[model samples]
Target chain A: MEVYHLYSGGKDSSLAAYILRKIGYEVKLVTINFGVLDSWKYAKETAEILGFPHEVVFLDREILEKAADMCIKDGHPTNAIQFIHEKALEEVAKLEGVERISDGTRRDDRVPLLDQRKTRSLEDRFNVQYIRPLLGLGYKTIRELTERLFIVEVKESEKLEKSDYEVELRHLLRERGIDPLTIFPKKHLQSRVIGWKKEKAHL
Target chain B: MEVYHLYSGGKDSSLAAYILRKIGYEVKLVTINFGVLDSWKYAKETAEILGFPHEVVFLDREILEKAADMCIKDGHPTNAIQFIHEKALEEVAKLEGVERISDGTRRDDRVPLLDQRKTRSLEDRFNVQYIRPLLGLGYKTIRELTERLFIVEVKESEKLEKSDYEVELRHLLRERGIDPLTIFPKKHLQSRVIGWKKEKAHL
Candidate 1:
């Protein structure tokens, strides 16, 4: 079975892709470029290093603006990020032979989360399986897995250019003379997968 | 208002007592000695160093045995620790002029947690307020506060003789020819508050 995985080149997404491949499922890495500066660069590099087929889907710039506007209106980025995530999933589900869509949503991830109702609706509407392989795992487990599987570079979320949709949304809001801090919490941490190393064969 | 705090001479309890004092409450430190070896020794030293009036209550050795037995039967220590905690609170609430009881439970503490129903029942039955000053704070916040307020010595829970209820329960179970690892999960990290140096007065 081939799974369309939402790839951001971050630790969670890369680990999710690796898990799928290890379990004998073909993975198609899809990165959505929402007109953010230097966003898809890391994803391309990571896919090459991991030796997986990758695709970059260009999204309309207005979609990011809409999400940022929602963040500004609500005084929080939760609803905005969820909107962008659902939009990415909707776009990925349209690809041919893509019956299963997967992402790196973890148990502790608050934003960009598809709740039970949203998950059910997406599966029913698209007639596809929406899977989150890391959903049962927490941040500690994800970090351990990433460390064991790949060489990673971790930094504050604000410092990472090639991150999740929130980064692009923050940049867009700032360009429009809005303070991103007003819509986002401070001091969040994120990771980037730089490369991979072969481990001892245990099987 | 006078509040009776359950003091274990650990990081969480010491920080909890300090927070209550900073917020202008007359705090009374109460340590329960359940016949565990060296359990009340650190609590005595910590209370003297912090310049708080402290009381040590002697609990029957059977209490620790009961909790240990519960752990052995259930294959976990969560229920056993909670039972001991409630019993300690009930005993402290009977003290003269003690209208409120508190502990150092932080947001990240999974064990020794009193669910909402149990908390409400304790308050209603005893007609005393049950408070956890560090309830809203996470582990990082608690550690930061402890660092700012006092010099601390930290060790693993298993390494320290003066620790939480689980330590004594494990000892009791082991003495009775039962392996504690069969009941308690491994590699759990807990800290003991050993010795403190006075910081510059900020108030």
Candidate 2:
């Protein structure tokens, strides 16, 4: 079976894709482009580094604007990001031949996490299975696994360029003269996979 | 890193150990023996067939008796089984050098499932990480994966010889002149891993 995994150029999603492949699924890395910025290209490049087939799926720019507006009105990005995340999943789940969809949501993730009800609804409506490979793993284990499994670059969220809703949302916020730093929390770290370690140590 | 997985010779736990090994953890299969029966031997044989090292961890027989009483009082095995599952996790979490522990819990499991708060509490109290690789997967995906991944034997729960707590619990109930059939629901199916599929087709 083939599973389409929502890809960001980040450690969590990359690790998720890795696990799915190990579990006998042919994994396709998908980067959603909402047209606010070309962040999907970053994800595509990272996917190339990881050696998985990759593609960009374009969503309406209107959703990005709406999510940004919600952020401005609510003074936070939690609900808005979650909104876009669900929209992204729905879009991918509807594709022909896409019977299994996945994301990198983790046990410790607060924002952009799909509740069980919504997950079941998505699966039932689309006749698909939504797999979150990292859902059972918390932050500490994820850190250890990624550190051992890949070479990564970590920096503040805004400075690090990865394919996630935040990049486009931040761009839209900047376009509206709203500083994203004020909306997003301070000192938030983001990571991008650079390459795998040379040792093949796990073998 | 080494992770001790709570194994029962069932497909779910076997698949969990497979995924953990793929993620670079040396997996040790631990079968809980509650002294009601020698069911751990079944799990040991399954682990050998899968080529993983296995061990039997003895838990207090008193706990099993208490859980059996809970079942008789509640007229159902749900609460009692959950009680024993948590105790088993606690006992395994205290073993030497066990920094990570895992189980075969799935997203749809109701009874004997650990909630987020309790999972966090276990991690904090024991200073260990709890990993449930199958927790993100539902019934359909698990069935698909297991069917393709292993050679399995299926039978009614009462007739199956897996190493789950139900076997010993049922034995104890019958010893007291109670028909375990009255306590456990009817037509419940159980599975045991007999061996791997030939051809190593996935490779």
Candidate 3:
């Protein structure tokens, strides 16, 4: 009945939230925060601009330090990554009576850990349906869509290996073992704004 | 002012076509078949049943054959997939005054070459808009949305990957993918029945 979107304050998550609303789903944005990060601020701002309620969950500091380690290019979704998402959704799903827990993970991601490993398993085990709206889309296309719609700020990536298709900077960097990238205030252009970037920080 | 659907006789495409029409677009269904493939017959049948003008184009082979390498996967679209899709749109783009090419490519593709690549490129290059009403939807959700409304029978996929997401189906497949996966056929299901088989080799 009700849907809760997994909001990360990055482009992918924000787009998922936006697209969910477009498709006529009653969506509530939930953010999983480690408590000590600027990413949470962006997530909060996104929820405000998009007109969705934001839920923040604090993760264990010890577990978070392992993010860089667990986020290895080849070994994503380490038990730690899956544990955090499932944990967050497990809590979110119970409160809102949400049947679906959605995310912004795109198709270009080769994070073996998330796609084929724990993320998939958690989806079935959590009894919470997971939806990735950007799964069939690439980075460039989303850039166009977001710009055309005039959505809030730039998409952040987490350092990633380069591929022909552009993934969100956050996801891209994350795969390469780093925190997500963030760009604020950004740019001004009419036609050429299809591909815009302000400043990317590896947080 | 007018938009048409790149219909593939599948559920998502059909639903997309119907939605665009409801939204007041002068919607039409276009299906492209490779040389002698019987994809045409089903497209015709589907168009007839659904009450739309179906246009069939035989490319013998379209682009993306070498780029994305079509034979690599069944339901999944690979890199350069968008290149081929735009090539299809290019042919369709040539239609007198058609300005927008809508497709059934949804939001949940494992690889998003089409929507992210082809769709965006065409919007800029051809200066025509590309619409995917199902851009943010996963297969299960699309199925639910289709059922909630009185939408008619459409194709899911041709025979290959058989993930049941595509709109084209091979005659050898007997059962409908929906009945087992979802609830239907109660009495209203009669109208949805489409037993399409090849009366000849060349469609």
Candidate 1 residue lDDT tens string, A110-192: 77887766876777788777766565444544565566678888787778756468678888988989888777777777778
Q: Candidate 2 vs candidate 3: which has greater TM-score?
A: 2
**Mind giving the per-residue lDDT tens digits that candidate 3 earns over B1-203?**
36766765556676676656543357777877554346466666766766778777655342423432332333333344454555667777777787777777765554433634545666677766666666645566776666654344433323222111122212211132322112211222212323222231111
Per-residue alpha-carbon lDDT of candidate 3 for residues A1-203, written as tens digits (9 for 90 to 100): 46787776555666666666654568877766654444555556656655678766555554455544444443434344554555565666555456787777665554311443454465566666666666655555566655545434322222311110112223434555554422111231111111213232100
TM-score of each: 0.49, 0.97, 0.54
DockQ for candidate 3? 0.15
Q: List the candidate 3 regions with Cα displacement exceeding 4 Å.
A: A37-39, A68-96, A110-113, A116-120, A151-203, B1-5, B16-28, B33-54, B59-139, B153-203
What is candidate 1's lDDT per residue for B1-203, written digit by digit as tens? 67889988787888777756654458888888777665777787887777778888777788889998889889988889888988888888877777788888655567677765677677777777776755534344455557756767666566765645776778898899998888877776666665554553212
Which 10 consecutive residues of model 2 chain B have the lowest summed lDDT?
A: B194-203
| Model 1 regions more than 4 Å off | A36-38, A197-203, B1-203
- Model 2, B172-193: lDDT tens digits are 9999999998899988999999
| Every candidate's CA RMSD | 17.0, 1.4, 11.9
lDDT of candidate model 2 versus the reference:
0.90
The better-scoring model by DockQ among 2 and 3 is 2
- DockQ for each numbered candidate: 0.02, 0.82, 0.15
- DockQ, 0 to 1 scale, candidate 1: 0.02
